[model samples]
Target: MLLFSRNLDKLFFRTLEKQLALTYATSTEPQREEEFRVLNLKHVKGQVAPRRPLKKIVPPPPRTQQMAENQDWGNVWPGPRSFHPATVPLPVRQGYVEKGVSPGKFGNAELMKIPNFLHLTPPVIKRQCEALKKFCTPWPKSLDSEEKCERHFPVEVSSSDYCHSSPTIRDPLARIVSVKVKLEALKLDARARDKFLRLVGDRYDEESDTVTIVADRCPLKKQNYDYAMYLITAVYHESWNVEPWEELKSEADMEYYIWENNASKVNVEKIFGKEAKDIPQIEVYSSAVDKYMNEGESDHTVEQYGQAVRKILNLPSLGA
Candidate 1:
């Protein structure tokens, strides 16, 4: 039994330690107190600050408000450009709407899409005219009448310029050039004038005595103008040009009656011999017959011819 006791004490061995009373431990400690901490915020490092509200911005008043009534428009709008609401002092509006006034200039497409004459005011025009006056020559006092002007400057050129709200500034009709001039201005002889009239066809206005040349074959205005001028020059020179066949044209092929080449002159010569050529009465007879044949028979023509015949043959006038 003593040996079993010795084995039990060896298996359940206890460690030796020094012990002190509770009062002695309380006295040895420097300071002993109870303490508390805030819940769930012990790990936070910095102090929290409140957020301030954002400030609202107010824009400056419209530029037109500061403008004066007598302000120079030329300085306001220096040149051609799209319309601006703030720049223009006027209350102009354009866009259409149901049961509403025209839309204001701000955010308006109608105003921007079209051109404005803001830079071309009356004062501006006067200033431009004054500046240009030095470079211009004064009008000739001698050309007081329209007829006088036409007599001196015979050629009248006409063309058009178009302005519209379109995708492109160019208009097809603007390229066409029209040139007109009086036929008398060409100073052509009888044969040359007849040839010119034939070459120009119906372009000639017999009543106005003017010929109009229209050129639209070219794409540009200047090109069409040049083409029109070339046509006029060509027709003028061509009319004067004489072909070999022209000399072969007989009396029968003549456009008008020729009193000198007719049998009437031959018979008259046979009657009076060479003296008919010197007779003043024979000349009047020739003019009357020429007019009667060329101008178609009329009362005036017949009366004129009868008087000439009476004068040549020394007969009494029927008017008596």
Candidate 2:
């Protein structure tokens, strides 16, 4: 009787489950139970399907193995894609192993994870360039040489674009913008040039004749570029500007010596009288003094100044 009751209960649940098509996993929503027999069965197991024979899975031979010896790799790897050992003919291996050689490419997770540029082979690159040539504009015939390019595009604004894996979307270096222009390109006079040099300090490359300003204070690349340009403009205009106190600057207060304004010129004029400016030796003395003062005292400059002074005074060389 007990066995019969259990069987009847089981049959009732099976019938109810089939009718409702509900499982304990699917009873996410609240459902009120009716009295006694209609109560929610906490352990309502579903009917299992009959077991069947399993079929085996077999992989085909590698594509590389079947490919001809002289097959075109360009066709095989048409574009960039994930690495497949079966497709690649090379015996690529990766992973660290102590005793044995590195694991073959067959199941190399490292190989699959890293980027591959098989599609960007020389032949493929040449083909791509040839195809793209039609879309590109021809080079300007006017700006043929590098010097001409520099003259035309004086402001060489440089910035970088990055494509890398990091926590942040934008790279710190990408935000930095460097503005480069030739010092001569600004067309600054002596006073303005001195002021500009003082303003830029080490940022000015004397060897290259370029003034470089790096702007990274702003967060965005465009803002930094704008800031760099603003700096260049400001320095240029400020150098040209003369303050009220500039007139008060005496020979002693000057940053660099002017050959025309110095006491040396007045002394030479006193010695030669009215004909000081007319003398050919006076010009040589002026050049030597100008170079010595502006370029700083050196052996070559000292020798030049000494020779010029002797020439001006009509002094004869003494035998050693």
Query: lDDT of all predictions, in order shown?
Result: 0.90, 0.87
Q: Write the per-residue lDDT of candidate 1 for residues 1-320, one digit (tens) a residue.
A: 99999987766553211233556777898895767865667556565677788788898888899988888888989888888988988889997899879998888888989888888999999999999999999999999999999999999999999876687889999999999989999999989999999999999999999999999999999999999999999999999999999999999999999788889888887777765678668889999999999999999999999999999988899977
Clashing pairs in model 1, backbone N/Cα/C closer than 3 A: none
Candidate 2 Cα errors over 4 Å, as ranges: 1-54, 66-82, 165-169, 269-287, 294-301, 307-320
Q: What 10-residue stretch in candidate 2 is worst by lDDT?
A: 39-48
Q: What lDDT score is found at residue 257 in candidate 1?
A: 94
TM-score, every prediction? 0.63, 0.68
